[model samples]
Target: MKGRQIILDQINGREAAALMVDGQLDDLLVEGDAPRPGTIYRAVADRPVKGQGGMFLKTPDGNVFLRQVKGLAPGDVMLVQVTGYAEPGKAIPVTQKVLFKSRYVIVTPDAPGINVSRSIHEEDERDRILEVAHEVSREEGVGLILRSACEGADRDEIAEDIANMLDLAEQVLADAEGAAEKLLDGDGPHLAAWRDWSEPAEVVTEAGSFDTHGVLDALEDAQGSRVSLESGVSLFVEPTRALVAVDVNTGGDTSPAAGTKANFAAARALPRALRVRGLGGQVVLDLAPMPKKDRRGFESALRSAFKRDPIDTTLVGWTPLGHFELQRKKARQELREVLK
Candidate 1:
């Protein structure tokens, strides 16, 4: 099939929304997003925190830290990767190590070798994918790690993604400039998806007939309340200023087996919903009560589902209260507000 066509449009006056006209697929929204994670921000080490053991590094956005820059002097400017968002009184966490994200690869400065995702268990396919990845950055510069998304991707797709990443690296190097300040803005949920898709895309200025995507409505809705599923289960996605809590509730008549099925479905949809909504950072998924045997199966289902997520999500295992812990790195504003 030929590459898909993408249309990017401004829905509200200030919000930018994009979609693939290959039948008005999912809408990609990315306006007024902030503190994009996985970016290299050039900042200077500022005054030391008295009892925190780490001094704040000041950037254009604000002061962020990781444990204070070693050998950091007041005037020394350092390159940091934004890890999380900054709350009312809390600074965003940052680190010296930088990871460059692409549609199919993650390039980092820490490792000099090319590493493929473990999901590609087939040894021959893994070698071929790695070879293609190496070809992308071998002569140009650093190595890149293949992401799970590249599992079934063709060489053309992989090559194109790598080229886009290499282009970004070039842009960053050129834009680094003589002075120091955030070197890269990085890609938020929308921009990253748009660029990665790279199919023939168009930007629509007016709604017209693309309303079928439901992305517009999803973006505009801000109730952020509990949503009921057809399986007689309810999902409550609550996002605080710094973290997100998802509570799963089953109906009174729901049987344990049915509840297990609903919870598994919820686990699969949770990350997709969060990514589409642009919700990020620490997340806790409180599933419906289940027996110990079922809990193991439910956790396996979660891990399987998250394997397809483009965002960096870490399943931190089940809590004593049976809540599933997750740490997805995202800093974009919620879709609820983005639509507003």
Candidate 2:
């Protein structure tokens, strides 16, 4: 997290996007007028569609794809959470098995159980949270999922999180009964960054309200079009219609060891670059050719690099043309669209 920073953008005195983070542009922002991913909408189940295998739930904005049809009939109204970040002309998924997320825990109604974050690798810490769950879990049809933020949290704090979420669950249920096409509690990009990434990232902005330095100052050309890493290596980034392509060069090297080292460095840097550029769908990385033995676990390393990204990414294996492949969910509008 050495070069970690969240640089904010301002358009006519309003927040827009992150201009730079570790020498990359942030594509992780939702459009200003769009509905956020965490927004809860009260939807009525419409007539089931035959081919799609899901019913269209009607909200004020448009239809939402609801996967569950069992025990559900036409005109059945209920609460649903927006699982997919919505886009223009695109209907995202929503579910009755809603997950209420907080800084410490995720409370799910309908699916009752207690679990911990998989990212919490330590068994001791996981068990301790589970023990707290046993104490806080009073209802049968509800479940608790301890977040990674709960790692070293005090017992009282965990209990308070549980109590607060339970109250929220009750509120969501009570409000759903008398509501029609209403948005309840929600979260947006700026608030989400404040809530989840405050500790790991330094929030930097060029706005008159805030002070700026570090990553913001180091950036010479915005969007990191010309990136020179501290290790004296450079990356050539090209955004094309089909895919975003990156070329890793150690200032012109042909040796296999040099190729491997550069590829590793590129893998480490690619996530931040991708997040900054908001380049998704498919990505191709060109690295210098190395021995087959040196390629071991490189794909995993690339996937791990993207683990911090808001959207999930997958390694799609290497191509026959010697390029590495990765695909991440396009969570927001493309960086180019926002720049306009």
User: Which residue runs of candidate 2 sit more than 4 Å off their true CA positions?
Assistant: 1-12, 15-31, 45-56, 66-78, 86-89, 93-97, 118-128, 175-180, 198-211, 214-227, 230-232, 236-243, 308-310
| Candidate 2: Cα lDDT at 59 | 83
**Taking the tens digit of each residue's C-alpha lDDT, what string does model 2 give over 46-122?**
87878777888888867888875778788888888876544445577676767787778888888888889898898
lDDT tens readout by residue for model 1, 73-129 = 776766778876655467878877677787688766546677888867999889889
lDDT of 2 at 274: 65
Cα RMSD (Å) per model? Answer: 4.9, 4.3
Worst 10 residues of 2 by lDDT: 209-218
In candidate 1, stretches whose alpha carbon ends up further than 4 angstroms from where it belongs are 1-7, 15-28, 50-53, 67-69, 104-106, 116-141, 146-179, 188-191, 196-212, 220-223, 241-243, 256-258, 318-322
TM-score of each: 0.74, 0.76
TM-score of 2: 0.76
